[model samples]
Target: MKYKTKSRHIFILMSLLLITSLVAACGGPATPAPQAEPAKMEEPAQTEESTQTEEPARVEESAQTEEATTEETTETASATDSTPDSGSVELPEVDPLAVTGDIISAGSSTVFPLSERMAERFQDEGYGGNITIDSIGSGAGFERFCVAGESDISNASRPIKDSEVESCQSIGREPVEFRVGTDALAIAVSQENDFVESVTLEELAMIFSTAETWADVNPDWPAEPIQRFIPGTDSGTFDYFVEEVFDKDEEPILSAGNLQLSEDDNVLVRGIQGSPYAIGFFGYAYYNENQDTLTVLSIEGVAPTGESAEDGSYPLARPLFIYSTAGIIAEKPQVGAFINFYLTYVNEEVIDVGYFPASEDTLSVAEASLLAALK
Candidate 1:
């Protein structure tokens, strides 16, 4: 019984040893089971992610290119619609008038400024050709207009004398009258002369006529001999002054023999500016142009300005004129057009140039008369 029990114990021990060896051979506590790898599926996912990122970059680059194209197109459109920097615009090429010929105008020195301004503006606005203007005195201009058929237009500082109009009719040229503006025959002296301020119309007549010395008009004035300057007899300024002041018939003062006569207002300005005792009269534009050296004199306690002239406060104010030949208007449509432009576009410039624009009604009448004469 003892041997059999001992053999059984040995067998159990052997079995226990065999199981322990088998566990050790398979794996110890430090080693774990190997896991299966999903390499094929993971590889395809990584490749797809890379493709998605690169596609966004391509899309961003394409978007940038499209933006650049849009900007370029906008710039091109802006350049195409830009205005030219040159002052000349692209105006239609059309003749502005029916008649195209040379224009010759001569008239009052007073009207010369306005007429010349019209001619200049007309040429700039693309009139046919050169419009020549002569600043001959009014009487001389009338003589030229009346003798035969010389001047196309005559500017007169005064209304046409009946004799002058008759002379035009004798030559078969009917004169169509147009008033351009108003003027104040400005009397001026040296700016340095401060004592004499104002003068009466009667005093002006005395001073301009044969009154040889300043003391003759007013003993209170400078006892120095009055150095007088007068516009020539041919001047419309002379005619207006004589008619208004001397009752159209008074003989000139014989004492005025020492007076200086000049056809040019500029000459008169220099004469007055140089002499302390000198007094002279001319168009207001001359005084305005030389205000530094010449002092305009107020007449009868009234100053001469556009407002004053309009209100009739300025005693020396007078209407100025332009006389067009009826024949010229009928024969030349450009002449009529030029006249219309002068009355329309240049009225304000006329006043700005130191002459007074006529009333609107007067201008309308003048325009109507011009159109009628053309018809």
Candidate 2:
């Protein structure tokens, strides 16, 4: 009987020790228990004073626990050290229905279709207010936004010129630029014309400036008069073309014979499609929209695909932009909301509208610009 009683006491003591270890392991550093660990380690069921024989062991364990806690805290602090150097800016997701009031944006006949599509989507997704996007040329658009100060937003196929910036400043506005997408200028001709599939840079320049007939540009072709259709002087498309082909000199192109110019790309498109001898150039989206009736010529043997445009392989690829002042955005909260929505969802709509999406890095900069303006 004595042996059985001793065996039962040993088993109960071991079980108590196991439970005490588990309870100690589960205790968190934040929980107040300075003396609890010492007490538990020294005695399973007795007070600290009654189990003083193991006091030294408890002290050592308490010191080790403190050291462990210090190490954990150091690790946590290192993990949370966040100082931004460079990356994407987080833009707020827009709920169009929650946005109110009218937004007026004008400029860039090239960007008009993309902006129009976005506005349509804003309305389709429950935006209740008005969004007016005018299809005037980029220069004319900036004139309205800066010199006239009648517009809340100005869209451009090119960056705002220094003079335009001064105009904005004179009106108590500092323009902010947001890069939205890239466009590869499409040189197109009527599909009925099969004489040329591509043209070199040298030939392209003459085709618009000096060449009066198809045979003037290339031999072994019919000597048909070269019907030249081009964007008007105020158009950003015209400016970009002149910069690329004429080294920014407009005299040659302006003096060319049989030249036709218009701010409307549709008019240019219709003119180019009217005759096999006709040729013109405009935004890739315009060519894409009228592809069935037009054949887009390759420049220097390189065509304008999304990849080519994004990679800078296409010679005529150019960045598209929209300009607005912080004052305008702040005064018209609706304009700010619309721009936020534009930056947030442009990639989803850009490709379908016939332009390539801006690179992620470029788009992030635009988002950062908007955030800084809002602040």
Candidate 3:
């Protein structure tokens, strides 16, 4: 009756493994536990996410409690040691109904919304086990996974670092990746603002970093000062922004005037809503959700859209990821099943979550990688 049933199938699978071992000891061919056919999970209706950083679309919560959910309660996760295999392969199919056991993941606050959406769908499709998604910054998430060795999956907006890979190897866990979707880092202003509609990378760099007033960045603009709202230092969104716009230099933006930083996107949204001078950025899903109250500024003459993001027309578009190891998936089949369900259903959920689907080819590549790892 408890949430920590530890999964009924896991116990049965363990019995099969023991039988296989005994058969091997008797010099007979061992029988492996059978994998069920991939389950057909009904896709959830897409929900609109807020477009502004001042607010976050709420994730539906269930009243069911997790008192006995005695799974991995650690705050951080272990980074698994793994490498990329770029062959075109088939996506893994999973029977979500057969999957069980708790799933613990934490990472990029930017990727948090999409992951949360997927996790909810997994639960709705008859998953009784616990699933916890933490919105800690990606760097912190990596530390949890790579240094602490606690999570089953590490959600990230960017790829794992080389040093992170080495860290995972040190702990005997090989990190495997699954590309889930695409995000357009929407640079947003309140809908009340009319003077600003779009900006170039140079203007953005100036606005977020060095410029004290709107006039400093653009001669035609008002002399009003710019208000900056952004994700905190540990955020992958912050890292991506600095890398792309500041060319990896943090000083200019970090020391910028009238800046407020937070790990939550909603904080940025609210900060921007307070004044026409305010501006902030986060994933497009937030923008889409809050479309009524916010305006997403085009970058480099191209607005952030699913078409633009997938086709690479959007300058701020980037791929999203979740990292896990084959070893972990094998040991905990529930993780494998959850990932399978995620990949299979993400296209439907991604739009609802306020992001774009990766191209069929890209998704297939991710699926292929997962299928290979589960072996």
- What is the TM-score of candidate 3? 0.76
Give the distance in Å from residue 300's predicted Cα in candidate 2 to where it truly belongs.
Answer: 0.7
Q: Write the per-residue lDDT of candidate 1 for residues 153-271, one digit (tens) a residue.
A: 89899989899988999989888898778888899999888778899988888887856677778888867777777787788998888788887753673246667887777778889
- RMSD to native, candidate 1: 38.2
The number of the candidate with the highest TM-score is: 2
* Least well predicted 10-residue stretch by lDDT in candidate 2: 45-54
* lDDT (10s digit) by residue, model 2, range 147-265: 98877889999999999999899989999999999999999999999899999999999889898899998996679999999998999999999999999999999999999998778
Overall local distance difference test of candidate 2: 0.82
Please state the error at residue 79 of candidate 3 in Å: 31
**Candidate 2 vs candidate 3, lDDT winner:** 2
TM-score of each: 0.72, 0.77, 0.76
List the candidates ranked by TM-score, beginning with the highest: 2, 3, 1
Number of backbone collisions per candidate: 4, 0, 30
What's the ranking of the predictions by lDDT, best on top?
2, 3, 1
Error of 3 at 139 (Å): 0.9
